[model samples]
Target: MPTSASVRPALNHLQQLDGIRFIAVGMVLFDHWMVGRIELPLGALGVTIFFVLSGFLITRILLSSKDKLSNQPNGGIGKYLKTFYIRRTLRIFPIYYLTLFILYLVNEPPVRRTIGWLALYATNLYMARHVSWMGTVDHLWSLAVEEQVYLFFPLLLFFVPRRWVPLTAGLMIIGSVALRYVLYQARMPWFIGYVTMPACLDSFGLGAIMAFWWLYERERFGNVFSRTRWLWISIALFIIVTTLTKVLPAIPDSRGWAGHHNIMSDVWERLAASFIGFFLIGRAVIGFKGPMKWILENPVSQYMGRISYGLYLFHNFVFNVFHTQPTHFTVRAWRRLSEMMPFLNSSYFFQFSFYLALTVALATISWFLIEKPVNNLKDRFSY
Candidate 1:
């Protein structure tokens, strides 16, 4: 009953995924800026969401373009690889490198020393060894993971036969689990396994598997997605897994990275979070109409999604400044205003508003002046 088209259809901007991006970045913001101030296992969940999204989106793109990779005129594989890398570089490098350069000038020598690792997309490795923040660039570890994924995953997708891709993803997931266990047994610092690709690649690999399945086998994918029960099942699993593994445990010792360092606990948490991310994201892509869809596909959520990359990048700096110097201009102004109107300053409201305002302004400016402009050039190298 399925059409025999070999090439998968190109997809439009996925509103649900955009909404998911907003949620992912929002979690990161809460984690970095408001965890102790509020209380949630948000940072890890946010990072996992981002990793899963990257894997899903990248695999989908590759599968859709398989025709070009196979049959493009003159050196198709090289051309495809070049185009992929160039497009990715253009999308990622300008803002990322600029952020690093700014930190090198503004921050201390520790940040300067880590520039090598950051530049080479090895920040995760650097942080694994250092086990602490490198000025405000500590979050670069997630970006580094993505960069490394972009580097190798394309090669795997391009060369590996399509039927075997799922199996490869499964192996990768197993390898990451094995790596985590081995490292934990060897008495390596938790940060090493936690931050490195070997421990986290399962999230990415699982996402890739989902993308491959969806693209290659639309009939089965559709049959499952059309049933609301599957979505309910995924949501149930996500809730149960997260509550048992993350939420309840986090309440007693809510120090996040400092409090929860057990290897087995982390392994389960990451795996569960990834599966949750995959299903949530998968439902959105499949056009499941529900309250979840409505929330995720709203214009506001999509806008938040649009500026998410910049939001994720710039928010930490905003948090760092606000946290360290509460007397800074925005903070001062807000505190003074709150003195005049007591309600404004209640319960971290002033602090949250200050960071949100600055981060949004910076992200908007970056999107208009930098990211959007460079992004326009992406089509030039398209396969």
Candidate 2:
């Protein structure tokens, strides 16, 4: 909540850290493509990666500030909630609304239909209804999952002790994994994925734990993470291997290491993915730089990260705008993109390009009109 001419994160929000956001969005783009056409069969795991990073990063921030936050009278729950929501609003609402506003003006019937759910943060439910319309603005489910967790998390901390954070996070992981296992067994559609929060809670919980380690457990982890590089290498290996091959498909698509496609296996993979996310994020923040950082934190890429919410919310609608055509090229034309962009060869590449371009346009427009202005509203909560 502290705002100044040079507002900084409690633990140096590194120059390239923003790049992970791009990674998450990119994975989503590819995953959607894979779902549309099963050429690669190894795409949606990007989202799992995203969830992992989310858990790690959010945890880092909270744990670092735990002491100061704890010292506050009554755990400072009131101020913390106010500031948190204010920042979230600045970050999430503006661009989201603008896209809806524009769509409403155009009377884009399909997008307009989903607006009600988005307004209520019931996007997961809406996506539930349109399970097959993966191209619809269904990705918003993750955002809903994250925000819904944020809504209750601080209260949890206020009521619970700092020492219990890790234990709580671990429980969340168990719950999330179990939930996901059940869903997998039921053969549920991906659209309602976030509804299975028990399977996802560990990601956020892991993040909270990381925040604790970075802050209070600094001494224990300082020499460990601040100096570790092998951790980063291993995670990078996992990211690449999982993306290119089916090394980690047990959770993303399959069931487990034993090749048994059961709920138990799915649970195991979910936990594994969460652990990987925790390490990757902690390693990066502590100075584990790699080749991807260069492009990940680039000015444009960072901006995309910033306006990513808008892009995620609107890209599907932008994509579906051209659904009138049964032809792939016709869909591309609706977005004003030329399918002849020589680089788009494979299903992954083609889907990546289309989703990328659509997100970029959405980001650019949303940043200038909605995101930036909405951020200004933070001045109101500066108290």
Candidate 3:
């Protein structure tokens, strides 16, 4: 393994990481569009990838900020916190709140009933409490989890001693797994185990651990991640564990055992998926090669990754569920198109393509008109 310090530079933008983001959002879109048509947990896998990626990126940013401010005076810490919160707000809050506002204007019933929780970024908690999804806005649970994590994770990183950060993250990982097992044994709703902030900590913790290794243990990171075998091992572990959840007989009151209802699905499947995400992210950070590099770094993938947040935000709404009134114009238009051109309704692929195209279009529009312009404000709050 190369022990060169040059491998880890100041974290700037990585296009390959965006490609990974594209893959993550693609999984989510496909899973939601083809809900009962597929047996795999592509949505969970995608969300885990997102959580790990968020943890890695945010931890890197925090650590880098800590390093920069270490030499400064008393106000350095304040500046660090201010800059981080401001940038995060600029990136996350604008579109999110705007979406809520629009939904409120349209009198969307789910939003009307849960606006309080949604506004506070506690949609995950609301779902856990209610034990029911809030329709199309159900996907917002992961966003809520990420927002909640952002609220405190920076403080944890900032206050903890540098040497202990990795240890702290490891404890978080273990705690999350333990929490899920406890919840499963208690027979709490499956979404509680899946969506609650504490139960989802493992994915974030794994990402944080990888970030720390890359920053402080470069040679070790390279030694492990540079080899292709670890990646394959992670894939095998994910597949094996996920497959077991599918193939195993369900326990009584297991909610059919596929969607995080069983102990294996609730507890182990996510951890397995997190490992895959951890290796995938670590590998992306180091670099990719050959066909994999091309796949991840191409212009289309990069652009998709750049707009992935919008893609994820708008995709579920684009999918018209049977017997549900279509509120989104794209969904309504698609319904009209299906009726006018009956052939479009003949195959699942046609519907999938329509939804994908509309989602991409909406995401593209949001990227240019809303996200990009607001994101430019982040430059004013740079760390």
**How far is each candidate from the true structure, as Cα RMSD in Å?**
3.7, 5.7, 3.1
CA shift of 82, model 1, Å: 0.9
Ranking by lDDT: 3, 1, 2
Candidate 2: Cα lDDT at 377: 79
Query: What lDDT does model 1 reach?
Result: 0.76
TM-score of 2: 0.75
By descending TM-score, how would the candidates be arranged? 3, 1, 2
lDDT winner between candidates 1 and 2 = 1
State the lDDT of candidate 2 residue by residue for 83-125, as single tens digits. Answer: 6667767777666666667767876655677678767676665
Candidates 2 and 3: which is better by lDDT?
3
Best by lDDT: 3
Q: Which stretches of candidate 1 lie over 4 Å from their true place?
A: 1-8, 72-75, 108-110, 231-235, 238-257, 321-343
TM-score of each: 0.88, 0.75, 0.94
TM-score of candidate 1 to 2 decimals = 0.88
Assess each prediction's global lDDT (C-alpha) against the native.
0.76, 0.60, 0.85
Off by over 4 Å in 3: 1-8, 254-260, 320-323, 326-331
Summarize candidate 3's per-residue lDDT along 95-135 as a digit string, tens digits: 88998898899887788989999999999999888777788
What's the CA RMSD of model 1 in angstroms?
A: 3.7
Which runs in model 2 stand beyond 4 Å of their true positions?
1-11, 34-43, 60-66, 69-73, 126-135, 183-195, 223-266, 290-295, 320-355, 376-383
The positional error of residue 5 in candidate 1, measured at the CA in angstroms, is 8.9
What is the alpha-carbon RMSD of candidate 3 to the true structure? Answer: 3.1
